[model samples]
Target: MSNTRPSLTLTLLQAREAAMAFFRPLLNQHGLTEQQWRIVRILRQQGELESHQLARQACILKPSMTGVLGRLERDGLVRRWKSPQDQRRVYVNLTEKGQQCFVSMSDGMESNYQKIQAQFGEEKLQQLLGLLNELKQVKP
Candidate 1:
């Protein structure tokens, strides 16, 4: 048998899963999927954005985004409206309920993050984040 290197893609996926494990329970408790949580988080930080921009920032495909947004809108956690300037474009923003939901979850999220930093070591986690950001810049 020969020594073989692990696949980078697999390693990254594993790391993501491991990291998400910490936050998954919190998200589940709030009845949110990862994609849904991502959109909520982005909207909270970015204010109103076009549907396309939200899809891009959330790394969600346009087709899937429609359903996700539909559900969010249906739940009254978010609101969407056709752009006044461009009927073809739609804008999305969190409703007051959505803001409350985020506020409710933030403390748990922050606690989990602090736990990760403590267990992983703040310096190591920072270094890992820096490396990951650098890797994201690499173009294939």
Candidate 2:
């Protein structure tokens, strides 16, 4: 007989996947892909970042960012220009249109966040968030 331990970690992963599946489709309705929405959310928080930095924060590869940036640039949601000091490096910032989108997305995200809080009480959510953050800590 195989010894099987019940795992909260596995359950959490499944719940996260299900939640993302539901939330992501709502953003898609606004003509934004999951990756694009992530970029918008990150920019809303960080103000501005180098294109490479945005890619890192989004947990996407640099190559994938090239296309995402290209699409966002074409949509006029993001503006990218070479850094004044180093022309080789490009910086990305949200345009007014991008900010509007960010605001809407943030509202939706916050609503979903509240639902999560309601599903699991504040204290449990806080504990889960702390545990998740601890799991996400950078390793040297």
Candidate 3:
């Protein structure tokens, strides 16, 4: 057998595509785009955060997050208020509705994760996670 080479990014893209196929549908059912869900989950976990912090944590662009946060606030999923110490700074927090949505999404996510775990099995999943972490740790 001959040794073959594959582009690392191509393999990474393939992995991301396959992963998204499984995760995206679950996200859609909860009335969120993946970016929106990312924001919701982050806010749910972190209590409250400024928009800049949310953008950084979500790995989403500031422009998109501005729109997302606006919609979330308009829909009552989030509330934003000027910080007491700095009126120019705004903080965001999950509303009761947002918390409810996060909880509901969590239940669905648990089942989805279980299904993926059963499909991939533990060993392969661990290996995949390790590989991904290794990639993350590489310096830019």
Number of the top lDDT candidate: 1
Model 3 residue 83 CA deviation in Å = 1.5
The residue-by-residue lDDT of candidate 1 on 75-124, one tens digit each, is 99999999788899999999999999999999999999999999999999
Q: Residue 128 of candidate 1: its Cα lDDT?
A: 99
- Residue 111 miss distance in model 2 (angstroms): 1.8
Provide the TM-score for each candidate, comma-separated: 0.94, 0.84, 0.85
Q: What does candidate 3 score on TM? A: 0.85
Candidates 1 and 3: which is better by TM-score? 1
lDDT of 2 by residue, 98-117 (tens): 99988777777788878877
Global CA lDDT of candidate 3, please? Answer: 0.87
- Poorest stretch of ten by lDDT in candidate 3: 105-114
Ranking by TM-score: 1, 3, 2
lDDT of each: 0.97, 0.87, 0.87
Error of 1 at 77 (Å): 0.9
Task: Give the 10-residue window scoring lowest on summed lDDT in candidate 1.
Answer: 77-86
Candidate RMSDs in order = 1.3, 2.6, 2.8
Q: Candidate 1's C-alpha lDDT?
A: 0.97
